[model samples]
Target: MATALSEEELDNEDYYSLLNVRREASSEELKAAYRRLCMLYHPDKHRDPELKSQAERLFNLVHQAYEVLSDPQTRAIYDIYGKRGLEMEGWEVVERRRTPAEIREEFERLQREREERRLQQRTNPKFSSRGIRPGLTTVLARNLDKNTVGYLQWRWGIQSAMNTSIVRDTKTSHFTVALQLGIPHSFALISYQHKFQDDDQTRVKGSLKAGFFGTVVEYGAERKISRHSVLGAAVSVGVPQGVSLKVKLNRASQTYFFPIHLTDQLLPSAMFYATVGPLVVYFAMHRLIIKPYLRAQKEKELEKQRESAATDVLQKKQEAESAVRLMQESVRRIIEAEESRMGLIIVNAWYGKFVNDKSRKSEKVKVIDVTVPLQCLVKDSKLILTEASKAGLPGFYDPCVGEEKNLKVLYQFRGVLHQVMVLDSEALRIPKQSHRIDTDG
Candidate 1:
């Protein structure tokens, strides 16, 4: 049978229907029903692809229903709290003789905690920058004789200009104030200096620096260029002398500093240089840092989705098993009521062909007949029918390995006779007979 149930159907499943047993069935009866169902729907017995798939699914459902209904404790829990109740942690507490009120309180507490966590996650930020360090840099430089200049710089935030630094120099012993602006593809920096040197040739010096696309240019009454290439240049102006330009070119293994003085004594100097080079540092950072981080995040999300899917499947299975139990109880009640009212009863039922030493071509298929056996089993006082294997009856055999079969019961109440059909594995329930008085009689 293709017994895969939808979500709603699983919630309403009848365990009795799944096991084909009465609600009042004893443990032995339940086990027998489970075994029979297992044999009928075992995936290995089906040859068709679709039927085998369905059998595998149905086989799992049968096992689940049997596991719950067969356990005394779990079955009791299921009867009261249902699928959701069985999932509670208090189930273990039940074994320690905890009161129902205590168990309920614990469940409520867990629910509240879960809700609070969810709300906190939604209302609060997922990512925060509290107490996080921003940026850091260290510089070390030595002057010609014994003089040295070095500093440590630190800045924080992308849009804000916040920085603190400590400077060391022989001729100057004063603090510096700086402002900076950074955006995508561009950045700018401005700084004011107050030197405490005795000369005071330039006590207050200001500098402005800007860069775009790896090309940096600076000015402080003297123009400088830190080009995308390995060459750097700075221009300085003197009072008596004209303009003096200094260029530094970095080669594979050495750096050449060329200072050309274009005073009133020399000719004007104009220079132009350009080259295309690879952004190896940027590519290396993406390969080593950003790419791996993004990949890890994607894998984590995929794992979470897989876990959620597994949880959903498990919940559906539990609901399906619970549905079967409910259905069994319903059918059991119906059978008991029919039997108590002295209504029709089922005897031997046949669902396949019957051969009577007859013609070779004669065959019966897809039909059930129980008229003769029911007539013989009925009594004037009372009727009783014990559950038996449907295939054990004479002139009966399973037609196909995974084919569905049903039973036809011959019933008579008062003087009206009727035939009712039901799944061969289902409990029998007879319809109520209506009595009418004849005017002539």
Candidate 2:
């Protein structure tokens, strides 16, 4: 029986190519080739630091290849299964043939181990923390009179913890420094603002500010009314005590505000005002003209997504049925060939199913029977020469970007069983000799 192997050990390295020798080279020839390559790539032969580093890496790979190919038992395993076969611990040669079920169980076990390892890596603190990012922003604006103002801001991560500096020069010179901390739900800020006027009335004004607030220096509270609307209020107490009430309706892009101010005197006098005459007209136009247009667009997008999902489901079902029909016909032909004394027999094969990208919410995958393609290839060499598009198999769709496609095959040759894995069907060629070694004997 074959032993368990780790996913990392399932490599496709060509040991013979590394040693510059043929696949059928004898043990002596393997050793001689290893020695020659080892001497040429040995780190000790290089003096430059970068060159030495590269040489050391090459030397390590060469050493590992030689170690496996030099041992008689391991070499036999390598000849069939390549790197993955030797990786199986306690693996031993057996006289009995392995069944398809047993081979499939072994593959499933390796897949489970790989998934576990991936989850562990994702949850590791060091790995998760590597995503923290830093950013900087600067903005400058000028009027027709050439009065200019600008600000520089720096932020860390996605939170409100940031630093900002502002400078302005017009009829007055203004400079401000601000710092914010904590998150958007609850945050605080400290700011210092200074303004200097140079005219008939030369005046200097400044304020030292501190608040648990929103934005750079405004203290406010807001509530989301719906998917697109909000209501909020802010109050600033200073020489001119002020109170502001804001309402955003229809969509957040449009807003209306009411401001009330009180003078700090013995008899406090209050004044109320609104600067939304033009904005009132704008909002009216938006509601009457833009809202319906935007709503229609949103509905169209949703309908498109639903149609796309339905189409994908239909396509997959049809493909699966077609693949099954093709497989049945191919199997019949293979049976006829075998009865006529042709040297071909059915083995094991696996084909994964295609899934809708929109419906893929997890890592689970579904596979179907694909032993038919392998069976057909055995009888007609021309079958292996077809394009990837016309390989006449089901579930051979190109994976979405960032995803990988793989095919696993098991076959018997010369009374010996073998297994192989192909990464993608981009090149629908027969499995090469390098992929024909049986890792699980």
Q: Which candidate number maximizes lDDT?
A: 2
Residues 20-40 of candidate 1 have per-residue lDDT tens digits of: 555566789889768856765
Estimated TM-score per prediction?
Answer: 0.26, 0.26
RMSD of each: 26.1, 24.0
Global lDDT of model 1? 0.45
| Model 2 segments more than 4 A misplaced | 1-307, 326-330, 336-346, 353-365, 381-402, 439-441
lDDT of each: 0.45, 0.47
What local lDDT score does residue 232 receive in model 1, on the 0 to 100 scale? Answer: 43
Candidate 1: segments with Cα more than 4 A from true spot:
1-10, 95-417, 420-441
Superposition TM-score, candidate 2 onto the true structure: 0.26
**How do the residues 1-441 of candidate 2 rate in per-residue lDDT, one tens digit apiece?**
111223332235556654545556788987876775566567786676866765676678778988887766566666656688766766654212444345445656786566545533332211012355534433322222223222333344555343333333333343334443334433233433233332113223333455454232233333333346544444344333343323333355776766544344222222122223324554685578656665675566545544444555455445444434434544676667664653445577655433568756532444445676456445442224222321223323222211344566676544445576554434344434565665664
Candidate 2, residue 315: Cα displacement in angstroms equals 3.5
